[model samples]
Target: EAGVVQSPRYKIIEKKQPVAFWCNPISGHNTLYWYLQNLGQGPELLIRYENEEAVDDSQLPKDRFSAERLKGVDSTLKIQPAELGDSAVYLCASSLDAVASGYNEQFFGPGTRLTVL
Candidate 1:
């Protein structure tokens, strides 16, 4: 099975600029998720899409961040007027929700490391 894929593993942007990250989840998976990982902390969920519905996005910073899961496949996350505190790893994960309830086996991408200066 193919695993999650993300581009531009590292990124550096000036404050106020916009940045975007992409993700391609595993094949045949029905659940896609995006999480933010601050330094020295575990990944905090930003959004989760079950097929096409954003079932969970309580942790997402709505002020400047947005996401989408069109076609219920690949997804993208965008940050506009980025802030310094937004510097962190953007991780994408996919799970076969049909085969399991818990995300213990979710496959994670290498992640995109962003730095705001």
Candidate 2:
């Protein structure tokens, strides 16, 4: 089976522009996550989806960022009027289970590097 898949791999845009990222997780995985990683910092969870429901999104910025996991299969993350601070790597990860069982290993995509000038 294929691992998580992400598009564009890299993106460059000016501040105040809109950008979008896409991700497809592994088959049969019930849990999906979107994370943001600044340089030299660990990935911080932006949102987490259990199937089609967003179970955790406390860290997601609601004003300019939006995300959706449609039909429990695919996901998209969008940043409108992006800022220079938004320049970072956006990572998508998935696991077989949604429960916080501590044993589930998440499969991660290569990540989308966004540069804001």
Candidate 3:
């Protein structure tokens, strides 16, 4: 099977500039997720979507970050007026319905690396 796809694989920005990242999940998957990973840290969950509904997003920084999965498929995450602390790797993952009868393993895409100056 093909893996998830992300564009620009790397990004660099100065603080206060807006930034956006795109994600495309694996086919036949209905659940999508966005996560953040600081250097030397495990990926932290940002948001999870069951199709078009964001089922979990408590960890997302609302002041400058927002995301959407309008078609319950490809997703986009945006940071307006970015901050230096926002420099981290943004990852996208996909899995079968989490509650489905089976082991639901999250398959990750190559992350978009953002560096804020």
Top lDDT prediction, candidate number:
2
Q: Write the per-residue lDDT of candidate 2 for residues 2-103, one digit (tens) a residue.
A: 899999899999999999999999999989999999999999999999999999999999999999998998999999999999999999999988686566
Q: Rank candidates, TM-score, best first.
A: 3, 2, 1
Write the residue-wise lDDT of candidate 1 on 1-117 in tens digits. Answer: 668999879999999999999999999888999999999999999999988789998988899999998999999999998999999999999988743655447899999999999
Give the Å error, residue 55, model 2: 0.2
TM-score of 1: 0.93
Better of 1 and 2 by TM-score: 2
lDDT (Cα, tens digit) per residue for candidate 3, span 32-97: 999999999999999999999999999998899999999988999999999999999999999989
Report how far off residue 17 is in candidate 2 (Å). Answer: 0.8
Using TM-score as the measure, the top candidate is: 3
**Each prediction's whole-model lDDT (CA):** 0.92, 0.96, 0.94
Model 2, position 70: C-alpha lDDT score: 84
Off by over 4 Å in 1: 98-104
Q: Comparing candidate 2 with candidate 3, which one achieves the higher TM-score? A: 3
